[model samples]
Target: LEWAGDEFPWVLEHHSNLEPETQTWHSKLVTENWDSPIIFTSMVQFLEVLFGGGSRGARRMHNIANSVLIFDEIQSLPVNCVHLFCNAIQFFVDHARSTTLLCTATQPLLDNLKFPDKGQLTLPDDRELVGNMTEVFEQFKRVEIKNLVRPKGWSEQKLIELMITQLKEKGNCLVIVNTKKWAKKLYDRCINSVDADSLFHLSTSLCPVHRKEVFNTVRQRLDDELPVLCISTQLIEAGVDVDFNSVIRFLAGLDSIAQAAGRCNRNGNLDMAQVYVVNPQDEAIDMLPDIKEGREKALRIFSEKDETELLDPEVMSLYFSYYFYERANLMSYPLTEKQAGRKDSLLSLLSDNHLNIGIEKNAIKLQQSFKTAGKAFKAIDSPTQAVIVPYGDKGKEIIAGLCADFEPAKAFKLLKEAQKYSVNVFPNVWRKLIDAEAVKPVQKGEGIYFLEERFYSENFGLSTEVVSKMDTKIS
Candidate 1:
């Protein structure tokens, strides 16, 4: 506050492929230098800066010192990077003189973070800002979660009936499923049954701008006490402001369940809200190992604890303890593909370079592979590609601009705007689109791909099914 003399957050940052203007702005305000009092960044950017490389950390070292680092929804941090992340934070506090604040309703067992050399990270005993967290969580409770996981899961028809009933009773309802395919299926099944105006869908398949439009419509419907139903993936689980009187969440970790509940009674307009955890028949989560493992862990807690104690801060701590303990072997990002079965991780490469057992190096610094470590680690740890979709007028306009004669300044600005209209797809889905000639590069070898307008849907989003020239295919 004292340094910038600005009351608002001017440095909104996510360090990745950026426009030239924004890049200049980042340096102009020393945002990369971490001089701003308040700046919002993605987990990817944060992890990249922390573990990406030595040069990045070195550049921001003095600036980040004494700054308060707040990690919202800390539970969403990747399990593979837990120990590495914990050690990095421990180093920041002990040696770099920075304060780290982990904020989440579902508090993880990060306090028990263990390092190999250092037995345990000694977190601060007291947080002056947040005293008596248990009472705080209890006092702030707004939703009551009910478990409805049955031996035979709810059928598609039964799930729709429940959603309709909830919408009629609660005025607005939100159903969050495990995957996009399921979300699309639910949206399609209810399209003819429910009024078009009252039904909505939200997922990463829709561009950010399209999703924002849906968010606005959903928020307005909730505010007006209208009977609205939304089918969505886990995209609305956190960082979304819309509130629903009732919500249906597919079973997952307690942390994820808590995040799902956050979307209900967000501002506490209702006296109390209901969150139903359901298991759907034929629900596919095999590809989503995180959600699959999380559901298994949550089931264990359900057997051991009462429903009322499920959302308790202590219970959350317990869930994370079980979660971390089970995945202790994977806390370090293991080098899998080429170096599998060697017990090598990015942490080892960054730390002691146990790979170099008896070798001695001079001033060349071959002991650590900072570049290799950065290259090996991905924040989400998924191989995904971005495709610019033509969702609406803005999306079309941006695409047109990018397709025009590639003027340097104009193209840079248009490329920045493309981010709002882009959708990320997995490699297989991308290949499907490419094979169908549904997407083409914005430039020859720039790696930026644009989706055909025919492939994008007004009701859902990107369709990955095989398509004939005359028809659109969605599966």
Candidate 2:
């Protein structure tokens, strides 16, 4: 639901009641009405209404007051805003008659969440919706998790060899890596080794539309029981519905590992699929603290238990408990102390009515920092700038549209279309692209950049070496 606005049209196309005449009405309702009987929205959208400043925000708050709120993939909640999120959930349930459902394969310890004033959150007695969860897990156990990590880690060559071996044995498989760089490298190598049509690459480096196209092709192959191999980053760990006979995952969080395993034998058509967890020697872990920390915790659990226990719900609970304990301080908004001069988190700012009294005198500036607070709340810590890529014919058309004129409505429509051809690059990469003259601003004064070169490929998506080549040419 995070990209609800972008996904609205795609979703509506499949709706049972969808009609050509009523499509515009449905679109308007979805875009304007937050309190629609069924609405899809991002967490940021929800938070803005609850804690946002201005009359507009206050007006939207009523929509959520008596509505049912469901948060899926609960473990993905940002650590820095967990307390704020929990408090909001509690506020809706207690004060507004709203019911809240937090769903996850590996549930976090919500009881451990400590707010500034409310203390720990309390969940209902029958919080575990499924009875005999252990039995359910046993019945649904469709994969055998195999630890392939060595102290020295597997080199790219060795990893490729392992994948080839798996492909020969299993016929179709999915290899999930930790980073886009590694995913691209592996895909480049494997594309050469296998039939180009049977191999697929997926990562955030490719826009959603491109990924969707790749997924469709892969699905068709899988449906026909043809050989297929997909190399992807952690983006495919959750939400993706495709199944593979085998899965190879670069070591990360236990919950993430579980999610990866889900892609294997997802429909239980296979007796028991195989999921291999490996640590790649070529991929650097220093830049990814979450992956590093998660690997440590998951490794500790792996040391104490059998590999098969990786998907056990009890094991998952233990993993999450340890994971949360290690980063307990970060569970609250980090900028609270810096901005408020006290250990007052966003929850404290929203819940404490006394703070609102000083708005006239500026005695407390909590209300003033609402926008800043929202800006600071990041689910993923790394800041990335989106760049428009020339992915295909449609991608080229979008880029052409973006460059042709500056009409607000048409530009807005083109920008939405451009999402399919967009890729998010780190600041360093953005700088490199700028230096290479491979990117130009979307408009005369706009900050958004568009790829100026044919640096994207159908198979690999974006070429990471484009900047270096551009630098060489300039030199």
C-alpha local distance difference test of each model: 0.75, 0.71
TM-score per model over all chains: 0.85, 0.79
lDDT score at residue 52, model 1, on the 0-100 scale: 60
Candidate 2 TM-score over all chains jointly: 0.79
lDDT of 1 at 420: 75
Model 1 is weakest, by summed lDDT over 10 consecutive residues, at 18-27
Residue 253, candidate 1: Cα error in Å is 0.4
What TM-score, to 2 decimals, does candidate 1 have?
A: 0.85
Angstrom error of the Cα, residue 294, model 1: value is 1.5
Clashing pairs in 2: none
lDDT value, residue 342 of candidate 2: 54
Clash count per candidate:
0, 0
List residue ranges in candidate 2 displaced over 4 A. 1-68, 96-99, 114-121, 336-376, 464-475
lDDT of candidate 1 vs native? 0.75
**Global lDDT for candidate 2?**
0.71
Name the top lDDT candidate.
1
Worst 10 residues of 2 by lDDT: 12-21
Q: Model 2: per-residue lDDT, tens digit, 21-45?
A: 1223322332232333465545544
